[model samples]
Each structure stands twice: as structure tokens, then as C-alpha cells.
Target chain A: MRVLGVDPGLTRCGLGVIDAPAARTLTLIDVSVATSSADADAPDRLLAIADAIDAAILKHRPDAVAVERVFAQHNVRTVMGTGQVSGLVMVAARRAGLPVVLYTPSEVKAAVTGSGRADKAQVAYMVAKLLGLDEPPKPADAADALAIAITHALKGGGRTAASGASATPAQQRWVEAERAARRRN
Target chain B: MRVLGVDPGLTRCGLGVIDAPAARTLTLIDVSVATSSADADAPDRLLAIADAIDAAILKHRPDAVAVERVFAQHNVRTVMGTGQVSGLVMVAARRAGLPVVLYTPSEVKAAVTGSGRADKAQVAYMVAKLLGLDEPPKPADAADALAIAITHALKGGGRTAASGASATPAQQRWVEAERAARRRN
Candidate 1:
């Protein structure tokens, strides 16, 4: 089973896909962030986001998606960004007919590093080590995404599921939009 | 110009459209909740949600969009719902290229009833009197949506303006999306 770990973010969404099977090694098939201009229209940028998701789905075809379940309701700006990130990922996962699972940060930490209150660095170190990676993942966000994938995979023993995808029609449509940027280029 | 106002939600989404230049009389186009099995597959349901938004757009080619803005960081569940509702709205607005303006609840109340802190009943009363309707709009949510449309028109002074809708890819995608959804539907 192939699992895609996603760090939902506004500027950069770190993605890491692990192919699970005989070799339990979690390989980093891809890593990058999806960005949109702050001054640009939110809708068109959303389409570009959908396009990126479609491209990722086509490239990996992962069976499931793992997202970090948010526990705290931070400030307004942060919440808005998190919402945007979650929205794009939800739209993309649904479009590709993949299941999505969410894990709380603490749950992920405890599962990965044996500490419910493990910090980001500790969790990242454990994630890379547990996944059998040579070096720690570059970005802290990327490592968190990997842990989300690993936690869900551990919960599923490996599979994609979306017991939590409840987006509106508008969300689906915006996701349908392909990248206008790519066409121009 | 016919303006559609949507209060999007997973269990219940309120929709209202008003014909401008006709004394601003609102035609209670449709009011209902879009529901799916809660325990159903998440991705499939999200796809269905997209279908629902398209249906609304095709049914009512709104010239502009007015939606309620998400304010304050509520509980986790409520916050999550706000994200879902906002995402759906952004998608729907982008698909039609219809300029969208968001109004805080207070603004809507103030515009409709001359008081930002007005209650649902007070706003409803104002809507009924302003439209010269026999009765207040049924389904409080629908009335809220209509109020949002009225607020935008009154505030915009009949011009189509929104925060996002520039020459950037994100803006273009949303503007073109309205056309695309129209053509497809």
C-alpha cells in the first residue's frame, strides 16, 4: 500500500509518499510546498492548488491521505491559513477518490516517539529514524507530515480512508479548476 | 442583476437570490439543506457536495456573490465547520467568476436593521418590510443569505467588487470558473 503524508500549509505543503510492502522503508518520493501570491485572487490560486493535487495523485496514486488533526484553535490568521490548507487537501483527496485519515499532533508524537508530549524536534528525529531514513527530514513540517502518514498507516496497518471528508460543492468546483499559471507558462 | 447569497454548510446550507433593479425584491429561489449519510465514504460525499454547488449555480446564474464571513475562533467543531463552509463558498464563487464580498454578521445585521447587534427576528422583520413581502422569509438561514446580498449591493453601490479578482492566476481561475460552470451546466 502506498501512503501519502501531507503537511497542510498555505505557502508550502510538504508531501512525502511511502510505498509500503515487503520493504517497509518509507521512501520520500516527493517533497515541496504549494504557494499562491498573497495579492492574487484566492479562487484562481485554489485552482492551481487543485492542479498540484491532481498532479500529485497522478504521479503517486496513493491509496490514502494522512493529515494532522488540528487540536488548538490558534489566532484568526493562523486558523484561516490552516483552513485553506485543509480545504485544498480535502478537495484533492476527494477528486482522486482516496480516503483521508487525521491524527492529532500529540497522538502522532506518542505513536512515533513514545511521548504524548514530544516536541517537534523529537518527533521529527523519531520520524526519520523510525522510517529508516539516513538523515532527518529537512523541514520540520515535512517530518510532521511523514509522521501523520506513519500514524495513519500504523492505525490502518496500511490503507487510505476518508471517514472525515465533508466539503461543500463549492469546494469541489474550485478543486476542479486546473492551474492557470501552468497553461500560461 | 440577480444576486445569489449562500450560507453554505454540510448538513444545512441556506441559499437566496435577489433580482436587482426591480426594487431589490428577493425571489426565494431555493432554501434547503444538503445532507448525506454521515457515515458514508468521505471522498464520495465531497464529490456529491460539488454536484450540489453546481446545481445551485446552474439554477441561478448570480451576477455577484455575498457570503457571511467567518469570525472569531470558536470551538474545534465549529471552527472546522467554518472552514468547510468558507471553502465551499470560495469554490462556488470562483467557478462563476462572480465577484464575492464577505460581510461579518454584524455588518449584515446593521445593513438590514440599522443595528449591528440585531437578533435574527429583528433582521427578519427588516427584510420583510424592506422587500414589502407578506411574511418574513422562511428558514432563518435563507433570510441571512438574502441579507448578505442586500448588504453587498447597498455597500458596493451596485458595483461588482471583491477583495480577490485580479489578473493573477488565482483570480482568473475563479472568474473563469463561473463561466465554466455556466457553460457546463
Candidate 2:
């Protein structure tokens, strides 16, 4: 299943696309960061990010989108930027008729590194190992985006077997999560 | 000068359009709220807002857009919603090549009510009086939106005389404020 992950930010938004065939095999498809200058006006900067996200969605056409859910309670300025970009990503994915799943940082860490308490370095190492890359992804943001995509592939959501897509551990996890969500609701 | 005002929110985004021929005489062109249901998914709700904003901008063809600048430091969830909608409005306006300005609540109040600490009722009353409306606009959101446009008209920015727009008290105030902002900058 192909999943596009977005680590939303204002100054720099990280995007990573990965193809995870099954439970353990993962292949890196693409990764990049969309940066906006602070000198520019707010509208221009936001439009730049929005356009970049729209272009990525058009180019990748991922089966699903996973965004790191922003907790705006911690920092006001940073959270506003993250929250705005996250909303833009969600809208873009939905416009393409793709399901969007939000994962907390702890969830991504636990899914990738086997522990929610794992440090950033550990998560990055696990991502590199999972993708069978010679070196860890640079700038942490790119790696975090890949980690988020991997988390969704492994423990959150992905394609279904009925939709001409093969089943994997990701589907099973998605089913469980949906059932839990239904129960809580 | 045509002005579009946006009172950004997740549940109900208020939009107001006014034509200030000379700034002091305001004619209400349109006023409405774009609502998103809480029961719907996040992406769908945000898309609804984005589409509504885009439609308003296209239909009104305003020369300027004014949005309430959200301060996310207050309430996390509420601020996130407001900030996201605000960003969407700015992008839509920018896409239409309309200049956008952000005004704080205090600025709006000061511009309309002659006091930064004015209450909502005072602002609403001033909005009605300034627009020559028989009654105060229903739903405080709509009134607040009109106040935002009025603030931009009076204190921040407006179409210049070179654009075939005439002068008024609002333009004089805006010029003074612009000089003050330039000095501070």
C-alpha cells in the first residue's frame, strides 16, 4: 500500500511517500520539504504551502494520507502554523477522495520503534532500518514524515483487499482501530 | 471600495461584504455564515469552509479581504479552528489577487466603538449605526465580521484615491495609522 505522510509546519512542511507491500517490507518512494520564507506575507507563504501540498498529492496519488495530529495547547505560534497546514493537507487529501488518518507522535513512535517513549534518534534509526536505507533520512523532519507513513502502514490504516489491493498487517490494525472507535462513539 | 470580512470559525464562519463608496457611507452587500457540522469528519468540515470561502470571494469580487487574526494562545481547540479558517480565507483572497489584512478584536472594537475595551454589544451597535441598518445584524459572528471590515477600512488599509475611490474620515484615519505603523517598523 502506498501512503503519503505529512509533518505539517509553517516554515517547513515535511512530506514523505512510501510503499509498504506487506508487514515488514517497505520501500521509499519520495521525500521532500516545502519551505516558505518568513519575509513573505502570510497569505503568500500559506498559498505556497498549499500549492506544494496539492502538487504532492497530484504527483503521488497515495492510497491514504497520514498527518501527525497537532497539539496546539503547548505553543501558540507554532501550533497555529502546524494546525493551519494540517487542515490544508486534510482538505487536499479529501478532495482527492483519499481517507486521512491522524496519528499522535506517541502512536507513530510506538508503531515504528516498539515504544512510545523512544527518542527521536531511535525512531529515525528504526525508519532507516525498516526502509533498508544505507543512511538515516536527513533533517529529522523528513524522517519523521516517513516514520508517520510507516506507522499508518503498520498499525493504523491502508488499502483493503476488496479494492483490488492485497491485505496486510496494516488492514488488520485499521479494522481494530475502527471497531474501537465505533465502540467509543 | 469593496471589502470582504471574514470571522473565522470551525463550526460557523461568518462572512460579510460591504461596499464603501467613500468609506463613511457603507452599503451592506451580503452577510451570511458558512456552517460545518460537528458530526462530520474533520477533513469534510474543513473542505466545506474552504469551498465556501472560495465561493464568497468569487461571487463578491472584493478589492480587499479582512480577517480576524486568531490568537491561538487562548483556547487550543477553538483557536485551531479559527486559525485554520482564517488561513483558508487569506489563501482564497490571495488567489483572487485581493489584498488581505488581519485585524485583532481590540482593533476592530477601537475602530468601530472608539474604545479598544468595548464589549460585543457596543461593537454590534456601532456596526449597525455605521451601516445605517434598521436593526442589529443577527448572530454576533456576522456583526463581528462587519466590524473587522470596518476596522480595516478605518485604521489599517483601504483602496486609495488613485483607484478612483474617494476620501472619508475612515481614509484619513487609515493614513494616520499607516504612518504610525511605518514609524514603528
Best by DockQ: 2
Write the residue-wise lDDT of candidate 2 on B1-185 in tens digits.
88899999989998999888776888889999999987776777898999998998989898788898788877765787788888888778877877787777887899999999999999999999999998888799899888888776664464344322223456557766776888999
Off by over 4 Å in 2: A156-185, B156-185
**C-alpha local distance difference test of each model:** 0.65, 0.83
Q: Lowest summed-lDDT stretch of 10 residues in model 2 chain A?
A: A159-168
Please report the candidate that would top lDDT against the real structure.
2
For candidate 2, the TM-score of chain A alone versus the native chain A is 0.86
Instruction: Score residue B140 of candidate 2 by CA lDDT.
Output: 92
Model 1 residue B113 CA deviation (Å) reads 2.1
What is the per-residue lDDT of model 1 for residues A1-185, given as tens digits with 9 covering 90 to 100? Answer: 67787777655666777765533555556655666666555565655655666677789899777776643366566666566556557667876767666666787888888889998888888777877777778787778777877776565433223535333343234333423434667
lDDT of 2 at A173: 79
| TM-score of predicted chain B, candidate 1 | 0.74
TM-score of chain B of each: 0.74, 0.85
Score residue A136 of candidate 2 by CA lDDT: 90
Q: lDDT tens string, model 1, B1-185?
A: 56677665555566777766544554445544455555665445445665666677788887777777765465556555555556667766776776666677898899888899999999888877766678878788767777876776555423223544333344356556766777999
